[model samples]
Target: MEVDTLRLGFIGFGEAASRFAQDLSQAGLRHIVAYSPSAAKAVLDDAIRKKADDAGVELLKTPKAVCERAQLIVALPPGSKALAVLRRVRPHLRPHHVYIDASTSSVKDMEQAAHMLDGVAPFVDAAVMDPVPINGIKVLTVASGSHAEQFRAALEPYGMNIQVVGEKPGAASAMKLLRSVCMKGLAALLFESLEAAQRYGIADVLAADMARFINGRPFEQIMKRFVCGTAIHSERRIHEVSESLALLKSLGASTRMTRAIRETLQQITDMGLREHFGAREPETIAPVLDAIIDAKRAQRT
Candidate 1:
């Protein structure tokens, strides 16, 4: 179907979907419809409603109208609510309808969503790879499922960068979650470090150290130092983390994260990590993490 004349529908017109629709409007794709599920209408502020109206997007009253009217549908429901939204629209879905779910959700959830529409409509698992608008509506997407290629073709003309990862429904979701774990963990670690440093009047020092660690030293070199050096420095690191926590406590800052870091080092030290790694610095973390796993298994036994 030619995108310019197609009646594209959005199941949830949240930030990302709204941006995509606005981009569609800018690109002269006129026939766009959206249903802000009544359940979600309460949370959507006036600005979002204004944007939708300004974009000339026909805001429908029910999910059924979106499902029955549009040939192509993009589901952008909240991660937790995606399943229920899908179930609501399931009765309205037809074989001609193509549904691409762009919700931030688990692999299991996406797979089950695909199962829900198994023979009814084409389902594409679409994982939005970047923050929308910051990347624009052209944000990269990793998609998977039997209809992934079709989904890619349908959206690519409108400035979307959709890379089809696999023919299985869960692959895109898995890729998204794998990246999330590492990226969000690093973000949390930095937030904790910066918050404590700010409280202790060492924000500049922490920021400078971070820049040096990221730009001056290669990331692999830093990883090797931290993972292997844990054998030697976990005790020193624990001491350092404790001192940092103490300072944060004195400054009336939250010590939860600082204490967690100390506990991690404490675990490494109590497990006799140094003995497990020996005198030489290892290039890999497999053995180091395995040693901890072995210790945990022994405890369980």
Candidate 2:
């Protein structure tokens, strides 16, 4: 598809859509239209309208109008509103239209959104993999569903970084959630520790020490060592976390994450991890994870 000739439509013109439309327009795709219900007042101070104007995107009154005008439509509403927006435009969607649902929605929601367009249009479940504020339209994104490649090919010409992960509707969303589990957990852990350390006026020093420890080796190697080491030394770690949690409470800092950590360490200790290892540390993380899984399965049974 020629960049200049493609008519792009956005169902919501929020920050992500505005940044994307602006960059796409700059990249030579001139015909961009959008419809945001909240911005329908058409007042000069309307934020979405201002964004659309800055991006050279024509603002339509309804999503149906956007569907009628463009062959490639992007659904950029909030995750909760994504399906509602899609439901409204679904009836207007045509066989030639390519619908991209680029929202941070649940896997089930993505699947439902794709199903809504089953015979009407090609559906692309695209997960924005990076901060759009920093990367703009070229933000890293992973796309899935049967029509993912088509969406990627159509927009790659406009500097959009889209990787097609699989042919399943929720594959990209699953990847996003998997990543979030680690990223969000690590962030919460850091926040808990830092807040406690700040009370002792050692937050900066602790952060520096943590940086050195984390950067000393390849993360994969460190990850294996930590997981395997935790299994073998679960009892000692439980004691250490107990002391830390008490200190955090004294400092008036939040103890939620630390308390959870202590409970998890106690669970591992109670699972006979030390006895399973028999004073020997596991060489890999798999054995420790498998033991935990087995324990959980046994409890369920």
TM-score, one value per model: 0.71, 0.84
Model 1 clashes, total count: 0
Q: Please provide, for model 2 over 1-301, each residue's C-alpha lDDT reduced to its tens digit, 9 standing for 90 to 100.
A: 4555788899888888889999998887877999887766678787777778888999998988898899999999998988998889998999989999898999999999888888889999989988899989778889999889988888998899999999999999899999999899999999999988988999999999999999999999989888888888888988888899889989999999988998988899888888988968888888888989998888889
- Cα-based lDDT at residue 139, candidate 1: 86
TM-score for candidate 1, please give it. 0.71
Candidate 1 deviant stretches above 4 angstroms:
1-7, 28-30, 37-61, 106-108, 163-192, 195-199, 217-236, 242-253, 266-301
Model 1, range 1-301, lDDT digits (tens) per residue? 6666577899998788888898878877777889885533634566766788777687788989887779889999898998998999999999999888889889999999999999999998989999997976778889999989987877778777899999999899899999887788788878877887887788999899889868987887877788889866788788777788878787787777677778889988888877766756667877877888998888789
User: Which pairs of residues collide in candidate 1?
Assistant: none
Off by over 4 Å in 2: 1-5, 38-50, 270-291
* Model 1 lDDT at residue 260: 76
- With a 3 Å backbone cut-off (N, CA, C), the pairs that clash in candidate 2 are none
